[model samples]
Target: MKTRITLLALLTAWHAQGQTLTENSMADSKDIERIVVTGSRIVESIDEVPATITIINRQQIEKQLKVSPELQTILATLVPGLAPSTGTSSNSSQTLRGRSPLVMIDGVPQSTPLRNGALGIRTIDPNSIERIEVIKGATSIYGNGAAGGIINYITKKAHADSKFNGQVSLSSRFSTAKFEDSTGQRIEGMINGQLNNFSYVASASFEENGLQKDAEGDVIGLKYGLSDAVMHNYFTKFGYQFNDDISMQLVINHYQSEQDSNLVDVVGSVNSGEKTYAIKAPAGTDAPGEPQGPNNQNVMLKYTDQALFDNTQLVLDAYAQKVKNTFFYSPVLANPEQGYDGGQSVIKSDKKGLRATFNSLFEWDDLEATIIYGIDALNDVTSQPMVDGRVWVPEMDMENVAGFLQSKWLIQEDLIVKAGVRRENIDLAVQDYKTLRLCKSVDICSIPMAVKGDTLNYSATTYNVGVRYNIAEYFQPFANYSQGSDISDIGRLLRTATVSDIADIQTQASIIDNYEIGFTSVVDNLRMEFSAYRSTSELGTTNKYDPATGVYMPVRAPQEIYGYEALAHYQLADNFDITATYAWVEGKDTKNDIYLGAKQISAPKGSININWSPNELSSMSLTYLYVGNRKRFDTVAGEHVGDKGPINSYHLVNFSGQYQLNRDWQAFIGIENLFNQDYYPAKSQAYTYSGYNVKGLGTTVNLGVQYQF
Candidate 1:
């Protein structure tokens, strides 16, 4: 009773601060401020870039965190052209611009491209991030695994101006419909400061989640679930300035999240209209397997010289990463003859890389140009093996070497042109292995075949060109064409091989060609942007269901994908503003003349945001999201096959607020699904696989307080 009363009291006080509005609380200008962007592998002005990039700063991140601590929620809420989150531990259904994107931290890659376990998005906790930069187009800027673009997380740095600075935060989460066992808690702390030429920052965080319940007060399904989960993260960075022109920095991070559920999944069939859910288990209903999640570790060292040779800038980065992801147990791994009823699999990867870049600046009368050239070398070893001593995919050792040159030119201070080219060479080696003989029943099983493995080689050259015209303050136009390659996902192909000779395997490097055109307009208190894009590849990356084997078989076919996106923002009053965004995408297999399934495409999505800041001490925001229906596949004999089920529309509303109660304390609250809407997420509705048609989160509330020192 006291806790509820205290929460109401805090809410009342926070609401009172916004009861009256004044002109002093309004913004003074309509000018759209610009920030530096690192999407091009260099810090450049936003207006100078020819593509759409979303930059979420620290203030924006903090505001969003008040509503949900999950990184998937934040990405779905802020990024356009990205699929909605699956509301689970896996991101297999989430793609950027109808394709998979490469995730990175401080320019170091975190994704396991060799096999793509789809667990890269949650490698690090959101609290350790200083900002998120998203580039929404294809290019060879950093190398392969960027066929859809790049999502880079920049880490926090020390407060060099102060001797010591720190912050501590505590928060709680619970379901509004029922709070019996649906509660969670989080604790986090960070410290940073500077001494002489040395600066350092460090942080630690921990969280434990209780059971998850739906709007109907039923426990959510346990497949890929987050119930009864525990997480821990540690991060640190140190820097030393040798002189005014040279410096070095070192960074280390470790993160782990695993679900140890007490409730078991009550599997349901989608065709029968039975939704999957969970319940309190009877005696010994718990499944056999290790907890499902990821364990990731990353280390990086950087050296910078601003005055290299007195005319160029030099930056060198060396990084290493180790990753492991475990999936839930299933009967698909049953091999009765081999003394194994069922088992689970784990994907393990290790990567080490080095990058060296040189930037040169030139100015001649009215033309100013910048040239950037670099070389990247990396080695990655990845494999998938069953927990019960069996190899599903043999270990693959890959070595990649690449060189790139990019340049930007500004002519007459009104026209900008950018171009770049990259050359890549990759080699993969695998030993001989045999395919798993998975059985659906005692009498029915897949044929086991001995496969031959040898070294494979691939080489490609990609190019990009673009132009941006600053015609006037009210209008700007841009156009660009770029190229990138899809590499290292061949592990899926090797595992499903039907041939015995390594030379007869039908596979090749998938070269991607991307084209884009867009424009931005800023008039008075309104700003708008629109862009259209098209991407094509020789081999499509998609999988089809094999009912006999209970497996998803990979399909290689020619593909074409196209999409469009729009954004608009208007300031209604000095203290109020509104923004809207929309995205639509479609894809088809050129060879078969059939629409691609949900695995590679997403339904139309839109969102509107209303922000109000009555004073510096208080702020409030309300957001609305809408997903439209999309049906591209016809049912075969009244059964939706594979991942091509029909998708239905849904709506959601969210609210967030924060108030400064005192000089050293702050209180905040966030409510997701404010109206407690009952619906299925897009991915849940599009996949007919068992134990997948789960409900989205209901009315969930988050409350927290922070102290600054």
Candidate 2:
């Protein structure tokens, strides 16, 4: 209660002073006064939008350069509703506002839900991004699997005004004895040019990861185990001015990663025994561990604003992604008695998808209404090799199609109405296969005797509605009711078997319904927003895995969650600026007899962040975050189980700053977890209890130099 009052008072004082919050201040002046993309169909001021959206501009990214890695390292520090769980190895994933939100880069979907040790989240480098847009809460505008929210990474676009401009920067780091070559470096370069009616922008970046160790100089379990990887990112964009009334842009983005690690079998024994000894043999090694040798590529073609009608704008986007994994797996250690094999295995897959949108705005009855509609299609194929590098399962494919319609109505100068709906259709198909009894030594296995149906179909529809009103000058108050759906990628994979009929297969749909009220205020030298919300999803869709068929069944019930978020910025006098944000959330299953989603992770219940910049040449920040305890059915590897109530709240602080030594040279220093808080954000219990637990880095310090031209 005290915290709430203090925040309210601060907000009232700031707004009462008369400062206008500029909705599109983050963008350059020529871009647009107000713009809306993923949340609503119409282009409106951020203050007038019914949903909550956070925009991180280029300036913010520049400020964070002296901080930790932008991908998963500093998630909890910047975004309010997002918290990083275990993100070691390749399986690191984040929970948004307490739920999993889908991430997209230039509309290319990127997620690795089931793949063990998959580095899906580290596919992009921050240097290639121009702006980061986040829509908090359920999202139906993009269609399919936006139950929590959406994080869109917009890449840099070619500028027409610049005839030729280029930027280059080099950075390095200082390390302790924990890392063999504590020294590492990053190089980035970008160029933009415009000739006549054609304009283009291209950039490239290369960065290497440093090692982390414990106080004793020994490795700290799986914490940052795969932190020694290297990243390479390249982006290019070209825009053509067909005529005064029409123009189109094409963008292509690509990134490649090469990660090699020797921490295979790092899962030492908790109980001493011969069974605890690590396997020594190469192919027959039964060491319960995995090595890394993986890479991926993405290519996309986007045609923006192709003028079909004088007043209508259309955008067409298409892309394909291919990811390959060649790693070592020890199946014998998984099930000693029924060991399949122990050797190197490779899993390779390809995904392709396309989305197109049409937008139109016109005056009707002295009122302005903007309408947006679009369609999306996706297809994925998988092919895997056995432990001996022999082809096992033939190629399998899954496909999806969706269509959506959304609109924004400007009822009054200060009042706005928004609504939208989407329909998604999915199909899964597999090649004919027959199984026949054969000896285990045979490299090639017989195909299934019977052929399964060609296709399995699943369909669903989702919708949302909301309103925003400018109650006071520079103050916009809004209320919204939004809905979204979560369709399991694994659930759709089940229909490929020959035994099930498309009609009998039931599609599980998790529904998100949200109720929220918030206000955005801008005051001279101060900007802030405060919001409270209640969101719930029907429980029937909780993940329920069936052992008999090895399928995740959907359980229906009611799951409720509620929370609040507050953000504020204050610029005191000449150069002192401070930014802060606070957030909280609580989630529960209301109708489950037994805690079905017991081990389900919840969003953090409390968080605070403070950034201070005394001048352009120097800056620093401090942040605190707390992850509430959750109730689970059984204890997980010594970790408390049952109504665990709440895990002890942990607080962490990070510091960073930069100093300009000369006109073209600068230095940076950053420290993470200054107090060295020891805690775990994510853990799992498998086998005798084996899973990644993010061991907090006691205190890590890095210093680097940057030179620009």
Candidate 3:
């Protein structure tokens, strides 16, 4: 840390900076090859985009995988505005710029818009991904769930070098603080190759973890924990080129992760300043209903024609997905009169969709324009039910049709303009049902109500416009205004209904407006991008705490959220580089004049990475992350409640090294929490709910080796 600090200070004092420093759509010639297809839904250069986007290449993906297998940690370390990892299997409360971003895989939406479980982020394994593209800010290009933006995972394809090629890898992991029973193993293998007009790629991976302990050698809480977990993933892809003008591709992936621990929660109340931990269950204790986090599957097929017509391209996509996310057993689901102690529930969703697009290009003497038009149709069936044949949330069927048009113009190859419009028509149907009776205390229970269900209709037209100007070599600025149309957590609203008729319930749509302005700069050795944004919505979807029943009810109000993000990278030498990112966000209830809690927002975050490549055969990187404090609401009776607890800051340092032993062999190792800082994660510190105050992982190590055929 000191060496890099000294280098940066000396370089600044001597004014030795040179080259390029940029963070934004238009970076430099080095990144021109980075074609972004998310924000625009078509093949286009980054410079043509009038928004902030982050692209994570394959090399960067593999490097971060060595440090931590979890994609959550990797994304938080790299993406500035994304919330920190929750250190659990669940990604709840980890918002992107104070809102949930739509997660997708190769343009297939992975998020369940009606009932978001926040498990979409982990639906696919890292080995199956070639890259990740993030489009920041509100957008309706993809429709429905993209309230905050989009995160699209681009999958891998077959390599063209050989007819048949394969690789195998194995890894070992254990807690550095206490390795007695805290050990794990992972095995992965993949084969990919090209054969004339046909190409294919397939991979399989499995990992099992033992006990996970903290710095003080205590097992973390079993609720949403990773201890004693087993995960499996299978992925396959096939491609055929009928001709140069036409081609087809198919992709399928299945991922499953579940924990079957022999330990149980040693339950402690966060409100009373006690910490929650886990210990071995009693000898005669029985297991829960089922192991949590069952499985997710995705299948996609695509047909594309490069020369469908003169100066026009055509693409068609068909996709289907299934997800079963089983949650932990909770007393909040208990009903005394029903002779139930606690129950477990699972959120299951089956989704199918089709999309068609056409891109037409036109060029003139001093201007070039591209027009993209598309149509999308989707059907989603989702429900949440208790494992013991009890209905918590009835099944909901939703169908949607959307039409969109996007236009891009480049004037003199320096000034770019973009505009788009999307029209969404949706219908949701549900049968007559009764809300389940839930109890927080024996005497305090929620009354069940039988509600009449009917088909609900919603329609919206959203628009976006942006412009960018490359005025000079050192300054590139962009500004944008956009809107997102969404039906936020409709399933929750229906499940907790108090009225006898669904129509009487507040089923208002959430229309969010977002405005952003940012600039990128490149000067010698420094490249930087900074932006500021503000978002507002008349009908908010913030959750209101119901102390009587321990339920979070939907509350409507006006909300305003604003934030800033900055990304910078400096090259100290030809072989050494230092990159840094910082993000700060704040939100408020515009109607109530009170700041939002951790449930809706997170504290500021900053990260730094120092990379060194000593030679062609060896490389190493050290990463540092800092989460600042956020104190909003005060405690009641000297005890914090809900997510209103104050958050204390924490620091993390990680180390990763890779070396090529031979032409076909390579070794890698990573050390997480290198300093053994015994601290609670940001979510754990601010979430005062039971079983949520688990400590962050201690010093952990991952060592692995790979071999190629």
Best by lDDT: 3
Tens digits of per-residue lDDT, candidate 2, 366-387, equal 3667678888888877655454
Give TM per candidate. Answer: 0.94, 0.80, 0.95
- The digit string of per-residue lDDT tens for model 3 on 253-347 reads 99999998778887776666667888888899866668887589999988877667877778888999999999888877889788888899999
Q: Which residue ranges in model 1 land beyond 4 Å of their true spot?
A: 1-33
Scored by Cα lDDT, where does model 2 land? 0.57
lDDT of each candidate versus the true structure: 0.81, 0.57, 0.84
Q: Cα miss at 668, model 1 (Å)?
A: 0.9
| TM-score-best of 2 and 3 | 3
| Model 3 lDDT on a 0 to 1 scale | 0.84
- Give per-residue lDDT, candidate 1, residue 283: 85
* Model 1 / residue 603 / CA error / Å: 1.0
**Candidate 1, 323-386: lDDT as tens digits:** 9888888776888999878778989999999999887767777787878899999999999999
Displacement of residue 42 (Cα, Å) in model 2 is: 6.5
